[model samples]
Target chain A: MTYCVGMMLEKGLVFMSDTRTNAGLDNISTFQKMKIWEQPGQGVITLMSAGNLATTQAVVSILDERTKAHDERDPSILAVPSMFQAARLIAKTLKDVIANHAQVGQRADSAFNATLILGGQIAGGPPRLFLIYPEGNFIEAGADTPFFQIGEMMYGRPILVRAYEPGLSFEEAMRLLLVSFDSTIKANLTVGLPLDFHFYETDSLEQGKTGRISADDPYFLAISQGWGEALKSALDQQPTFEF
Target chain B: MTYCVGMMLEKGLVFMSDTRTNAGLDNISTFQKMKIWEQPGQGVITLMSAGNLATTQAVVSILDERTKAHDERDPSILAVPSMFQAARLIAKTLKDVIANHAQVGQRADSAFNATLILGGQIAGGPPRLFLIYPEGNFIEAGADTPFFQIGEMMYGRPILVRAYEPGLSFEEAMRLLLVSFDSTIKANLTVGLPLDFHFYETDSLEQGKTGRISADDPYFLAISQGWGEALKSALDQQPTFEF
Candidate 1:
């Protein structure tokens, strides 16, 4: 299982994904789930995937291979004119990969499905974020729904719902995501560190910033411990129930 | 859907349950999920259920009727001599009810299955808590696993895992539970207001303090709002990530 969240805020886009993947309790491994396609001043796109490891890797391989092909026969995600078209390309690739795998004796209902979060900016357009489903359909983040979460989402969702603001700064958004991810890691073993984080500023048309947070990262440790203590202190301050 | 939690603490036991039940988003109603059977000085058993509303209601009705029946030929839950025995009685009754309903043409896999949290104390024995499955088998909460939650549990679980301590006072436990429930309610539409809470002191062997917290209740409102602000404040206080 994986846990990933993408937010579309006034400042830009924030993306985070856990690296833990497991076939079973005893077969756990660390694998990066975030992929970036950059065209310097032209455009920048980031994709984070969750679901079957094999399927996600296959989708990424197909997209990466297309970008390096000598022939201009196929359009790569990096060459897509807009973020919408980039998302469409990734969705189509994902569906074709899953369908091809299913046709070769594997049941489609098996765990070979993958969902993705695609977000970035094209030089002339504003930033955008989308959640691409395994069925190849996708939905863009709108004013009413400013964020999208996939895989092991429920454990970390309350904080996002309660604290998310439309105009948060990049720093504040990262802090919020850290707290949310910490809560999930504490409550569930399937989702572990290190975590991948990306920050994209609207219209920059360049790879903004990216980093990895591991189990012993000082800032993450502080947030995890600080949030727990703060919650207990808050509970202590609340009025007790009267019988 | 429902959300219910039962915890066995050093001081005693704490049980909290939401009263919302819904077959679909359009069809929502309030229904109590907590049931108590107390012989005052002899024993006190509390049952909180989640899952199929009809199955839970049927199980409760059967137990209630047996306690009221004057005939000695049928053994009632009230006659159970120990907390373990009481749990067995409830589990057996629950399995029987589900089986009986299945025999009437409904698929066994239908929503007619219920999961329950049973906690209480009997004179001359230590307090106990059990999670009864639909198949009539149950597992008691122990030192390693001190609490049990059923139905829409993920949203509220992280807080419980972070803050729960066996030595917490009854008031502290209730506060913890309120924060957990508030998290659930904020994140999910299926778990709603008018929560039922019960507290049983060890060796008291009597019905404990119980109450309901509705949507407009002042203390509940305070907890709900205060927790959100507290979380945001905590996030602000955390050290910002350096790129």
Candidate 2:
């Protein structure tokens, strides 16, 4: 299980993904699920995935190889003309990876399915975010739906729906994401720190600030504890039922 | 889909369930998922169910008929020796309903599966809570886990984990539950108003208080709107991230 979210805000795009991966309840490990591909001053692409680890890793490795080997047969994500094209390329890679795995062992196709959130900007296009399905189709986030979440999303979604504002600054956005992640991590064992995040300043066409939040990060700890007390206080303020 | 929660508190027990039932996104209707049997001063039993509506309604009907007809073959839930026996009786009835359906028409057994939360007190026994599964087995909630939620639980669970207290007054407990339900209703279409609630006071050996909170109920409306504002204010109080 995993939890990844990408928000398209006025300042830019913010992405966060948990590292924990598990094959079963008893078998778990930490694996990076966020990948950033950037050609400074050209294009920057960020992909966060949640699903079968092997399928996601294979898709990422294939995308990385294409970028590094300068292979004309397969264009790099950084070479895509628009964020839409990059999403299409990633969706195709994800579907192909799942298909190849299914054929090898003749396993259920669902076993190798993966979902991804892709957000980025190319030199000539505006910043965009998409939720790519395992079937090679995708949907973009726009004004009405300004964010995308993949993997173990329910526990953290209500807060995002209520607190997210289009004009929030990067700092406020990160604070929101951490609060969202904190709610998820506390409720499910499958998602945890250290969380990885990247910020893409709108129309920059370059890599933006990025950081990893370890388990003991003071800010994360404060948010986790503070949110609980805050929620309690919030509840206290509501009118109690008279029965 | 549904959302039903039963919390065991120091004062006694509190139960809440949403009334929305859906065959698909387009086919939805209001169906009460809560049943109460109270032999005032003898015993009081409350059952909240989530899952296949047909299976749950069948179980409730069967239980109801047995109590009404005074059938020798089927005992009334009110006649159970203890809260544990009541849970066992409910679990077995649930399992039989699913099995009977599966044998008649070769559909997946999971299609008929239903989960239930049973909480109450008998004249000689203390108030207790059980989470009954479709497999004819159930587990009781204790100090470590004081509540049970079935169906569409994730969206509403974090607040319960953070706000529930054993010493809470019935009013405060109901307040906590409304917040939990409001979060779920906003995040999911499958769970909605009107909400049903029941309270059993410890050692009362009888039904406590029960009510229905319709969508337009002023208190329900206040909590729903007030909670969002409180949450935003809480978020504002948190220190912002520095990048």
DockQ of each: 0.73, 0.90
Candidate 2, B151: how far from true, in Å?
Answer: 0.7
Per-candidate TM equals 0.96, 0.98
> For candidate 1 chain B, which ten residues in a row score worst on lDDT?
B72-81
Evaluated on CA atoms against the true complex, candidate 1 attains a DockQ of 0.73
- C-alpha positional error of residue B217 in candidate 1 after TM-score superposition, expressed in Å: 0.6
Give me the runs in candidate 2 sitting further than 4 Å from their true place: A71-74, B71-74
Cα lDDT of model 1 overall?
0.90
> Candidate 1: which stretches are off by over 4 Å?
A108-110, B108-110
Instruction: Look at candidate 1 and give me any clashing residue pairs.
Output: none
lDDT, candidate 2, equals 0.92
lDDT of 2 by residue, B1-243 (tens): 999999999999999999999999999999999999988889999999999999999999988887888545457777889999898888989999999998996778499999999999998888999999999999999999999999999999999999989899999999999999999999999998999999889988777888899999999899999999999999999988898
Report the TM-score of candidate 2, chain B only. 0.97
